[model samples]
Target: MEGTEKPVSALGIEKDLNDWLSVTKSRNGTWWHSAFHNVSAMVGAGILGLPYALSELGWGPGVTLMVLSWVVTLYTMWQMIEMHEMVPGKRLDRYHELGQAAFGEKLGLWIVVPLQMMVQAATDIAFMITGGKCLKKFHDTVCPNCKDIKTTYFIMVYASVQFVLSHLPSFNSIIAVSIAASVMSLSYSAIAWMTCIHKGVIPDVDYSPRSTTTAGMVFSFFSAVGDVSFAFAGHNVILEIQASIPSTPGKPSKKPMWKGAFFSYIVVFLCYFPVAIFGYWAFGNKVEDNVLLSLEKPRWLVAAANMFVVIHVVGSYQVFAIPFFDMVESFLVKKIHFRPTKSLRFITRNLYVAFTMFIGMTFPFFGAIIGFFGGFFFAPTSFFLPCIIWLVVYKPRRFSLSWFTNWFCIIFGVILMTLGPVGGLRQIIVQAKQYKFYS
Candidate 1:
C-alpha cells in the first residue's frame, strides 16, 4: 500500500487479458454447494498430518497458529475476490490470471504459473502418497504374512482411478464429486475425533521442549512452524472456488461467494481444531504423521477412515489439479498451437495425474512433502500475492493500519518462506534416511 503502481485499466490491457479469465467462465450454483466444494478442497491429506503438526507446539501455540492461519487466509480470499470484482466486465477465473491482471504478464507466466503449479503438483503427490500408504496399512492389518503391497503400486492403481474419473469436462461437472468428497471428509473427521476420544488422553505426556539446546529448540520451532503451516495451505484454490459461485446476469453476486466461503471456513475450523487437539491428546507425542495410523486396536474403524481418506483424496486431487491442468492446456494452445479439444483435455489431465503419481513414488514421505510445498510455495501464494494485489489495487495509505497489515502479510510470508523451507527441508532430510522407495 505504501508503494502503488499505475492502474491496469489506464494501460488498456484489461480487454486483452480478459481472454484468459474468460476460460473459467462464470457458472451458477447454490451457495451451500459452493461451500461444500471449498470444504472438500481444503480438507484433504492436510488434516491427516494436522495432529502431528499441532502436537509439535502443544495445544496453546498450536491452536494460536491455526487461528492466525485461518484469519490471514480468510482475508486473502476476500482480497482476491475484490480484485476480480474490480475488473467490471470480466471473469478472472484462476489465480495466475489474477496475477496477470494485477501485477503483469511476467509474474503470471514466470512466477505465478510455476509457483502455483509447484504447489498443486506437490499436493497431488501428497495425495498419491497418502492413498498408497493408506492402502498399504490396510493390507498390513488384514493379512500380516502376505507380501507387502508397495506404495508405488498402490499409488499407480489410485492414479488409474483418477484417470477414469478425470474425464469430467469442467468444474461444473465435478459438483457431485465435490459434495461426495466433503461428506466423506466430514465422516472421517468425525470417526477420527471419536476414535481419539474413546482412546482417551495419553498419560503423563511431556509438554516441554523436545530439544535441550537453544539452537536445537529453534530448529524444532521452525520445523513445527512448517508442519503447522501445511495444515492451511489451500489458498491457491480459493479464487477458482470463488469463481464457480453463480453470479447474477448484470451484477456478480458477492453474497453467494461470501456466504458459501464463510460457511465452509466454519466447517474447516470446527473439524481442524478438534481433530488436531484430541488426536494429539490421544496419542501424545508418539502420534504418526497420519493420526489415523496412530490407532492400534479397533482396526476396523481405522481401516474405514483410511478408506474414506483414499476416496476423498481421489476427488480432492482433481479439484485442486483441474486449475493447473487448465493452465497447462491454455499454454499449449496459446504457445504451441495445440487445438483445445475434449480429447486433448482428457490426455493432458491424465498425463498430469500420472506425472504427480510418479513424483509421489519418489517422495513417499507425505509429511515432509506437505511441509515443503506449504513452506516454499504456498507461503507466497497464500499470503504474499493477495497482499500485493490488495496494496497495489486499493493503495491503502502509507503508515495506516491496512498498509501495515499488508506489509505484515508480505513480511510474514517471507519469514515463512525462508524459515519454513529450512524447517521443511530438515524434515525431508530426516525422513529421507528412513524412506524406502515404493515401500
Candidate 2:
C-alpha cells in the first residue's frame, strides 16, 4: 500500500490527459468565437419573455430576479469549472460525463440524461414556436394580400430546415452557425431595445405600473423568477462550449474560459436589460408575451425584428438540439444496441427531430411551453444538479461557506421546481383551452 500510487509522469502529461478527456478533440475556434457560441446558447428567444416577466413582478422584484439569475449562472460557471479542474486522472468534458464522474453511472444515465434531454428538447420546441410565429407574421406582413398560411405549416417548414442542418456531425461544424446566430440574436436585441428605448424616452406615451394585485404578488414573483431562470440558462451546454476553446501547449486553457465567462455575462446583461426595463417601461402590463408584439405600427421594423428572430431561433434550436441528439444517440447505441453507423445516425437523429417538432406543433403556446421547461428543466440543469454535483465531487467541508452556497442553490432550485411548474401548468392549461391547433 505504501508504494501503490503512480508517479506524476505516470499520470500522463497534460497533453495526454487533454486527449483522454476529449477536451481538445475539436478545438477549432478561438475563445471569442466560443464565447459568442455559448452566449448564443444563453440568450435564446426566451429573451422575448422578459417584458412579461417584468410586467408580472413590477420593477423591483423583476430586476432583482434577473440579476439573481445572472449571478446564479455565473456562480454555476465557477463551480462547474472548479469541478472540471479539480478531478484527477481524467477530466469531465460533457454534461453526462461530469454527472457519471461525480455521482455514479446509474444516476448520470437515469437523471442527468433525461433532464438534459428534456431541457434541450423543450427549448428546441420553444424555438419552433417562436420561429413559426415569427415566420407567419413576417409572411402576413410582407404578403398581406396573399392567402393566409397556418402557423403549423411554418413550423413544419422550420423543422425541415433544421432536420437538414442538424445532421452535421460535430460542434465544430456549427461554429459558424453559432456565430451567425449570436450576431443575429444581438442584432434583434439591439433593435428591440432601441424600439423600446425610443418609446420610453418619448414624452407622450409611458407604460408604468405594469404589475398590481390582480394575481398574488408572491405567485407572480416566483413565476417571473422562473422565466428569467430560463432566460439565463446555459449550464447544460457550458462544458461543451468550454471544450471548444483552443488548447494551448495541449492543455485546454482555462484563461480563455475565464475571460469568455466574464465577457459572456456582459453580453447577456447588455442584451437582457434594456429590453426588459425599457420594454416594460414602454408598454407596462399591456405588453405582449413577446415584446416584439407590443411594438406599434412600423410594420417594416416589426417584420424585420421577427425576421431576425426566425433566423436566430432556427440556429439556436439546432445548437440546443445537439446535446439532445448526443443523449438520444448514446441511448440508442448502448441501450438499444444500435450500431454507430451513418444510416442509424441519420434515422435516429432525424426521427428525434421529427418527434420534437411534432410536440411543438401540438402546443404552440410559447409562454406555457417556456414556463414549464424553465421550471422543470432549467431550474435543475442550471442550479440543482450543479450544486449537488459540486458537493459530491469536491467534498467541500460540511457546514462551511462552500457547503452553504451549494445547499442554497439546491434549495433555491427545489423551491423553484415546486412552484414554477404549478404556476406554469396553470398558464399552459389556460393557453391550451385558448389554443386553436393550426391557427
Candidate 3:
C-alpha cells in the first residue's frame, strides 16, 4: 500500500482520467474473478452450441475441438503473459493506445480498433442471443403463461437482467454473481452426470467417427480445437484480474492470481470435457442445441440448469459490455469533452442492451448464433487478434516454423480463423433458407 498508487479524485476530466489510470493499475481480480470471467464467457454460448457442433463433426471431431481449443488457449494465454511483461503498466484498454505508441495512429485505427471492435461486438451479440434463449426456456418452464412468448419478450427480459447486473456498484457484487454462476455450472454438470448414469449409458472410448477423407479428418481436428478455444476464450479478462489484485510484484497476491487462473482453467476443463464426452455418448445423433438438453434429468434439475444458464449468459454480457462502455466513454470525454452524466450513462448502457437484444430476438436459434459467432467472431477475438497483436508488437526473434509445437499452433490458428468463419457462414445461410421457408 505504501508504494502502490493513490486513488484519484472524482472531479475534473483530469481527475477522472487519473482515476481510470489508478483503477487500472491497482485492479487485481481473485481466483473467483478469473474463473467467473472465463466460465461466463465460454460456458453459456459454447454449451448451447456444443451438441450441434458434435452433430456435424461427430464425437471424435467434437472432443478433438475441445482439446485443441485448450492448447491454443494455453499458448495464447502464455503469449499474453509475455505481453504483460513487455508492457508492464498498460491494460488491455490501452491496446490501441499501445499500438499507437508502438506504431502510429493510422495503424492503430485501421488495424487494432476495427479488429477489436468487430470481435468484441460479435462476441457480445453471441452472449446476448444465448441469454435470450435461456430466458425463453426459463419462462416457458417456470411461467407456463409465457409458453408462447415471442423471442423479443425473452430478449427484453435478458437485457433487463444484464442492465441491472452491469451497473452493480461494487466488484464484490460481481464476484458474488460469479460465485453463484460457478455453483450453477457445477450443479448442471452434476445433473448431466446423474442423468447419464441413471440411463445406464456406458462411457465410450471409441467415440471418434470414421473419416470419409483426409480433408474430413483434418476439418474434424480443427473443429475439436475450436471447441477447446471456446472454453478458453476469456483471456481478455487477464488484464482485469491483474488490475484487481494487489500488485506487489513478488508478493502472495500475485501468486494467487496466476495459480488461480491455472487451477480454475483445469476445473473448467474437467467440467467441460465430461459433458462433451458423455453428452455425445448419451444422445449420439439426437443431441440437441445443448448437451444438457440431451440428459433426461429430473424436471427440477432441468429447470435449475436453465435458470443458471440464463444467469451465466447475462453475467457474460455484463463483462463484455464493460470494454464497450469504456471505449464509448473515452471517445466522448476525449473528443467532445462531454462528461457522462447519470442520464447519459443510463441511456448509453440501455441502448447497447437494446441493440444486443434486438439482434437476439431477430435470430433466436441458439445453435446457429453460437456457431456463427464462435467461428466468425470469437475465433478471431480469441486466437487471431492476440496472435496478430503479439506478432506485431513483440516481433519475437528467431521465428521457427520447423518446431512441431510452433508450426502446430500457427497452422491451427490460421486454419481456425480461415475455416471457422466459412463453416459458420454456411450454417447461417442454411438457417436463413430454412427460416424463410418456415416463416
Candidate 4:
C-alpha cells in the first residue's frame, strides 16, 4: 500500500506499527483534556431521552434509579481509572489490556472486546440518528415552509462530517472537538429543561404510565431501565481516554485522569438531572424521546437547541468512533498482516462510517435503539463488568465491604442486562410495524 513503512526487525515492526497508529503515538494530553473528553463521551444523545425514560418509570422509581445509576457508574469508573496504572511500572492503557491482566489473555479479549465494540458501535449509530433527527428538527423549526427533506439525506449530511472527523487520527487530535461537544451538551441540556419549566406543566397533564396493560407497563419500565443504563455508558472508553495521557513511575496517569473525571461527573450531574426531572415534570407523561422535540413554541430557541444537538453529536460521533477505528486498524495490521498505511486507514474508516450511517437510516428508532443497546451491551460493560474484573484480579476479602459492594453491583447489573433488551426489542418491533423504509 502507499506510504507503508517497513521495520528492520520483528521487534521493530511491532513498535513501528504502534507509533504509526494514532492513539499509541499520543502522550501529551492533560487533565482538562480528560475532563472534556469524558464529558463528551458520557453526555450524549442519551441524555435527551432521559425524560422519556422517566415517563416510563414514573417519579419515585425514576428519580431513585437515576441517582443510583450515577453513584454506581461513578464508583465503577473510578475502578477503571485506578486499574489503568495498577501494574506499577506498566500501564494497562486499553480496556482489553486491563481485561487481559485480570482474565487470561484469550478469555479477556473474548469477554471485553466484543462488549466494548458493540457499545461503541451502538452508540455511534444512535448518535448518527440523533444528529440527523436534530438537523431535521432544526430545519423544520427555522424554515417550516421549505420543502421537507428526507431524513435519510439529513443523516447522510451528519455522516459526512464524521467522514472528515473520523480521520483525525487520535484521541488527543479531537480535543478541540470534544471541548466544544462538552459545552454544547451542557448548553442544550440546560435549554431542554429550562424551556420545559418555562412552558409549565401541560394543561391537565397526566403523569400516568403510557401503557394501559400490565405486561405493556412492565416492558416499558424495563426498557426505561435500559435507557438509563445507556446514559452512563462512558465506562467502555475511560481507559482509552487515559491511554492518551503521559504516565511515569513518579507521575501516574490515574491521578490526573481521576481529577478530570470527577469534574466531568459534576458536569454529567448538571446535564442529566434537571433535564430528566423538570422535563418530565413539565410535560408529564407526554415528553418526546428527545426532549427538544417537545418544546416548539419559542421557534428561535428550540431551533438553536436543536442546532446545539447537531453540533454536540458531531463531536460525540467521533468520540465513540475512535475505539472502533483502533480495533479495526490493529486487526488489519496484526492479524491480517496488512501494511499500516494511509490507504488502509482511509478505506477502513470510511466504510465504518458508512455502515453506521446505513443502519441509522434504515432503522432510526432512537429511543428503542438506545434502550436495546443500553441493556444488551452497556449494562454489562458500564453497570457491572468492572466489578467482576476487580473481584477476579484483586479478590477483595469475600465478605468485606468491597466484596459486598461489588456483589450488589453485579446482581443489579445482571438484572438490568437481562430485562432491558426484552422491553427495547418489543418497542422496536412495534415501531417497525408502522414505519416505512427510509422515508
TM-score-better candidate, 2 vs 4? 4
Each model's total of backbone clashes: 0, 0, 15, 0
Residues 349-392 of candidate 4 have per-residue lDDT tens digits of 99999999999999776547678888989999998999999999
Per-residue lDDT tens digits for candidate 2, residues 346-435, read 887788779868877877776565666678788898877888888887788989998988888888778777777766776666557777
* lDDT per residue (tens digit) for residues 1-439 in model 1: 7546547674454333322332353366667866877887788888877887776666787788788888887777777766766776666777877887777878666768888888888888888888888777777776769986677888888888888877765566788888888888888898898999998877787555555677656665677777666666677777777676666556575667777778888988878888988888887777877888888668888878888888888888877877777677777776797766767777887788778888888767665756666778878888787898788778999999999988987887777777777766776786677877655
lDDT of 3 by residue, 279-379 (tens): 66666655675765554446566777777777666666665566566566667667887665666567776787777766666765634544444555456
Pull out the clashing pairs in model 1: none
TM-score of 3: 0.81
The regions of model 2 sitting more than 4 angstroms off are 1-25, 201-218, 246-250
Candidates 2 and 4, the one with greater lDDT: 4
Candidate 4: segments with Cα more than 4 A from true spot: 1-10
lDDT of 4: 0.90
Error (Å) of candidate 2 at residue 298 is: 2.3
Pairwise lDDT winner, candidates 1 and 2:
1
Candidate 1 regions with alpha-carbon error over 4 angstroms: 1-26, 143-146, 211-214
Candidate 2 C-alpha error for residue 262, in Å: 2.6
